[model samples]
Target: MLQMLSSLLHHGSSVPENSPLPYTVKVSSRAKNARLKMTPHGGLVVVLPEGFNKKHLPALLQRHEAWIKQAAARIEVHRPEPLPLTENGLPYTIALHNSNEKWSVVYNNQGRRVLDVDDAGGRRLLLSADVADAELCRSQLLTWLKRQAHKHLIPSLGKLAAAQDFKYAEALVRLQHSRWGSCTSRQLITLNTKLLFLPDHLVRYIMIHELCHTVQMNHSKAFWALVSKHDPLWHTHNVEMKSAWKYVPAWVSAQS
Candidate 1:
């Protein structure tokens, strides 16, 4: 039974012996109590507090199987909507709605890579050859998006840091599926490249949230106070951030 439960947690159940139950276990050093969460991106995560016995996991999963199924079903009903494609859809161009930049994608038999970019002029660029495979096209376009984040996000973070009188050792832009951004004890900050899809204010809130962590690492009252001082509408922004994934086009999230 324990082995069956472990399989259910990792692989989700498909057969009667296992049941149609699925979950992921996360052991956190800071968690004080066992918890469960269901998000559109990371279907379900069972957070185990520090020092909690692993032996209790199977029973815990069994107890919550019904709730898990209901929650998963609810998620299926409200999945993020995919971005609409152009009239000529296949091998379509990728557009950054917030950044105001667009790249034309193409596929062919002879090309060095899945995507070969030709950018003679800044305004008009072409992704030449072998992009016919949907996955390859998505990968290449995501790469382009990362480049844009480095080009734009890094400088923007510097400006925000300076304006707020907050200092950080460095900044990194990455494609994070589960988080918007994070700041480490070393003062290194990582911003999600996906922020390019969100509105400016929401993006700024995430920056401010991480910068605040430089002084208060934990999400204690002091940390929140500091965050509010920097970004006044942080609460609203935080709530909005939960649903912001909807803004990301389906072609992109599918790759995630």
Candidate 2:
């Protein structure tokens, strides 16, 4: 099955000061082995299968220390510079590339905390909040982003699945931190709201990737063969995904 860690522990926990790097542990019921995952933004995550002995973690880290340092350095070299933020700590414009929509955000201090799209076919957003209460504005904007993802991303995924004759139970959208998308063993697909920032082709690639997982739960040769059949450019898209985080706005990470 496509095992995914359901619980995260030691969120900001790190090894000793002299250790290689900071890391967190994740417990996965479906995991059959312990593995390490490194992401540019999430840093390092040590995933352990259920019933695994915690005492062995030290040994695992020691063995992987060389690989860890190399991977960390690679990420550091390719990490994109942070996006500049507006003076009010909010994005002046919201762009949903997947939907070919760009929204201009207008902040109005009408003494109320609310966000609404203008009548220009939803191209403009009117955010009414105390300009100083950036936190509230961000929360409201995030809620709106979820709605947009539901309106755009979910339907697009459904259409793609139908076109490819892929069977899936349901699809969901959330503000995920490290993952672009995931598919459960039960055939449910969860997409990150940050996808709204990606190009349309990449978004479709992620959808197809998850849909293929519904048929083949593991990334074996057969699974990749299936993906290749559906998305001929899966390899190119996969490489592009490694650096796609740059498309997302700084405010999105700030809210997280």
Candidate 3:
């Protein structure tokens, strides 16, 4: 009887299980108590409370099947609208980002990396004309972006690591599709290039949070305490990180 029931649960009860239920509710207990969650993973994940019995999980999932399907279908959101085309839509003869003391964009007609700060024009950046090819523009822009990351982020993480006496393996910037940052067991950290659009404070806070993972792998209280030691205002940064996408112009992803 148990084998038959297990088979039914995994394989769908012959075609009869296709019927839909009106509403489904997932009861997840991650910490000490069961907390309601609006959005679970692609299917559903009921995080059981500590010392919870695993035997009753099947029944719980079966009871909420309708709700799972409904929530999944209703809450799906397509990726945001792509950035509109440029005025002419012609591939840029060149696209550039100036990283001299500040950040700004440039267009066709510039040397590869000749940045001349002209004091004469109230301190404006002047690029040379030789490196003005399309490929060179993007390449230079990437290099400039990495340089920006190194300058703004590396030192901050270094200070955070020092405070905790944790040795970070490495820190790198990536063009990931969805993840913001991650910490490996080796203590190496990877940050999303989208972080460039995030405010510097939030970016630093994320770096600190990931670096702290060197000492603590999970989001347990100890891990958060580690983060708070370096950045007491981290909660504000966390909130800002949540809304960071809205502020990022579409061009950043396009360049990479």
Best prediction by lDDT: 2
**Evaluation by lDDT, superior candidate among 1 and 2:** 2
Candidate no. 2 TM-score:
0.69
- For model 1, give the RMSD to the true fold: 7.6
Clashes of each: 2, 0, 6
Candidate 3 vs. true structure, TM-score = 0.49
Tens-digit lDDT track of model 3 for 1-256: 0000000011122222343432222333446754322221212334457666756655655666676576555434422333343352212222221122333343435444554434464433344434435345444545555656666566666776787677888987765545678888987887766566555676667777787788898888998888899899988877656445543443343433
* Cα lDDT over the full model 2: 0.81
Task: Give the worst 10-residue stretch by lDDT in candidate 1.
Answer: 1-10
| Candidate 2 residue-wise lDDT, 11-101, digit = tens | 6565644466888877889899999876445677888999999888888888899988987887677655554456767887787778878
Order candidates by lDDT, high to low. Answer: 2, 1, 3
The better-scoring model by lDDT among 1 and 3 is 1
Kindly report which residue stretches of model 1 are placed more than 4 angstroms away from their true locations once superposed: 1-91, 114-125
**Order of candidate numbers by TM-score, starting with the best:** 2, 1, 3
Each model's lDDT comes to: 0.70, 0.81, 0.52
